[model samples]
Target: MPAERLDKILAHHGFGTRKDVKRLCHKGLVFLNGKIATDPAVKVDIGSDTLVIDGKKITLQHDLYIMLNKCRDVVCANRDGEHQTVFDLLDESLKHKFLGGDLHCMGRLDIDTEGLLILTTDGKLTHSLLSPKTHVPKTYGVGLRDALSEEEKLRYAETFSKGFWIDREQNEDGFNCAPAVLKWREKDGKFTLEGENPALYEAVEKNSSGKSDCLLTIFEGKFHQVKRMFAQMGNQVVYLKRVKMGELSLDPQLEPGSYRELSEAEIALLKQRQTD
Candidate 1:
């Protein structure tokens, strides 16, 4: 919202380098408030002033927030040597638009993980979201290698709630994980509540041969935390996909490898959650 030089703003928005924007100004291709803007050093209020280039009005936005339904096999990076990155899924125009900004993923998902990934040029928001003090909850839908027995399920839930020490390669003594929530899902996509329906439990038991599904919510992000938690319980996470972070869920309409800008309401909700 602060005033910035016209050439700097143009360069930041991917119009071109400072020299290029100055050239456009000299050519009378750049206009400010309906008048030809020949002084590249002229300062303008981005929020209130209108900028036109080549007869087209240019919207000035200093920040960008993108929600991507990330697909598996894509790394959460700008570049990867052996795999496609999440940024690679973005269109060329978007890449160019934020070229001068620090566009990056707020939080990373493993190569095998899929689902909601946020890319942003707002570094402050990213810091708030990733700060450990925020304790923002992230939910994941998990595919387990094997179904848990009723006793095993109870044990797993209780242990997770109480927190447990898990081995980490960096620390020989390992570390204690924070408490997490676990919920079991029936085969028909309904949550299986305790003593709600014996029929649903039997159905899940019969259908689950070597695989089952559950949802896990954790407040903190650690290296391979979800997979490590399952491994500590003697189970394997065969598949994992993030479904929610804070109050924002992945848009069901967005297919894998597709993305769109977050709405104003969604952006506000994330900021609210960060403070809470």
Candidate 2:
């Protein structure tokens, strides 16, 4: 589908607000396929064409997929306490643009545990990943108190799929827990698994004897979901890292407290979820 509006395209690129984009369009600052465009309503296919804004080529990354090696004591949100937020690490220009009412985070990761995070201005993409019905999988590297056993894996899965009631008063409504699809893999004193491997399923089930880290996937995004899930397993999550969300992965080039524009392929994956 061709992008029907210039402001939409600009917003998709993590440029700025719709009004701000419209202003740029009216000022002839936006270019379509290299030619100056003055109409905010101009239609263009983001996938096939190259867009340039103010001499900088803009690839309409429909949604942003960010991977942050979150440092301790930082929050994974746009705004928070004295501790810096994940958004604080982004480029000033990107911060100014996405910080506006136009953009938001797809899900929340605790301040302590950090890894892969997906942020975007596209609400539909956010919905697809956050919705319980869609079951978009998210993998995380977890730190545990002791080794995991075969029965623990079964218990973890059972508790995640059914639901657990949390006692904490973090949520105003009530402490209701949501179900998730949980699995863990152990590696070298820490449970680890590559995104690409054949025995990943079995690795999560194998019993290991040691205080180690584990990798797990959760299908739901509730308040403190990952940490709480581990709490139920009698394991404290000392560290956490999200590896994937749907078809998007944290860009290898982006480091801790850093972000970049999403590539064309990643945007296409997000757009594809609009229909399915």
State which candidate has the highest TM-score.
1
Cα lDDT of candidate 2 equals 0.62
Candidate 2 minimal-lDDT segment of 10 residues: 203-212
- Residues 16-56 of candidate 2 have per-residue lDDT tens digits of 67888988988888888778888877887756877888888
lDDT (tens digit, per residue) of candidate 1 on 120-203: 988888889999999999877778888778788889889998889988755544579999998876557666555333432332
**Candidate 2 regions off by >4 Å?**
3-67, 96-101, 146-212, 247-254, 267-276
Candidate models: Cα lDDT each? 0.81, 0.62
| TM-scores of all predicted structures | 0.87, 0.65
Tell me how candidate 1 scores on lDDT: 0.81
Q: Which parts of model 1 have CA positions greater than 4 angstroms off? A: 97-100, 170-173, 192-212
Q: State in Å the error of residue 208, model 1.
A: 16
At residue 105, candidate 1 shows an lDDT of 93
| Inter-residue clash pairs, candidate 2 | 186-191, 187-190, 187-191, 190-213, 191-213
